[model samples]
Target: MSSSIPVSTLRRFHRSTLHPRNTSRTMATKVERSPAGEGADFRPPWFYTVARVLSWTLIPATGFYGVFIYDFGDHEHVFQPARRWAERQKAAFLTLSAEEKKIVGNETASTKP
Candidate 1:
């Protein structure tokens, strides 16, 4: 009974299931290179300059200050002063009447030295 099956039919079914149809979507496009890497010498944008300066100077300075001073003690002790300051600020802001809020808002945009 096994000999009744055709070998060619089994081979055709196995080949179709094992191999997928090739398509143009599977092909990769070639990249064109600039001669002597001329295009690679382009200057970074203005923000890139700002980011470089901050990364090289401001960020490190801020980190040093935070670790050495702002977070000098345990969580409760170190953050107590900042928490009190924030509470005072909130209380002062809340105590301000409508006119005071308006005045404070205006002064924020003022060019006073």
Candidate 2:
């Protein structure tokens, strides 16, 4: 190694070392956002994942409530003893007149031969 220094290069370095710096302006700043560099208007991949999970969870829950919890299956009706009795009473009240019964009996007698 050599320990020699040049005179002209030393003077140029001394001149630049004393220069002033600007302190009036500052660097720009912005709000924090997603890693994809999208602003508030952007929808991330995580949102899609959460929405899919929510939809999948809710669909089965809705079906369960509709099928069991809400008792939509019980909306259909079946005839019981009371209904049968009422229907029998209605038929009895609407029975054929005596003249109609006589005519039916005459027809049966004629058809037997």
Candidate 3:
């Protein structure tokens, strides 16, 4: 079987699927002045502008304070339980006999393999 189409068939398919170019004069027209043309010169109220500037300034200031200056000590209460549990674990490990610690180390190594 020939896997070829005639050039005339391709041209006919393209012509049938192609959209017509826009010909309306309104599509090319530009408005001289809009109904709300007075708003073109509008500026936000003084307080609104001030608030916007303050918000933008505070956003970065707050981020910088949190990252570099904020005392994490003030929030330690939130992690107190986890911190206490870790301290207890460390103390318990410290109290273990040297032989017990060696056994733990050996067990840990064997578990990995």
Number of backbone-clashing residue pairs for each candidate, in the order shown: 0, 0, 0
Model 1 ranges with Cα > 4 A deviation = 1-48, 53-75, 96-113
lDDT of 2 by residue, 25-81 (tens): 211112233344554336656997999999999999986555444533434534344
* Candidate 2 TM-score, true structure as reference: 0.29
TM-score of each: 0.27, 0.29, 0.26
Write down the TM-score for model 3: 0.26
By summed lDDT, the worst window of 10 consecutive residues in model 3 runs over 23-32
Error of 2 at 110 (Å): 82
Flag regions of model 3 displaced more than 4 Å. Answer: 1-44, 74-113
Clashes, model 3: 0
lDDT of 1 by residue, 22-41 (tens): 33333211112445454443
Q: How much lDDT does each candidate structure score?
A: 0.65, 0.62, 0.66
Please identify which of the two predictions, 2 or 3, would achieve the higher lDDT against the true structure: 3
Instruction: Give the top-scoring candidate (TM-score).
Output: 2
lDDT tens per residue, model 3, 1-113: 56499888878867654435433333223222434563232444597789999999999999766655555685665556666686788898779788998999999999995
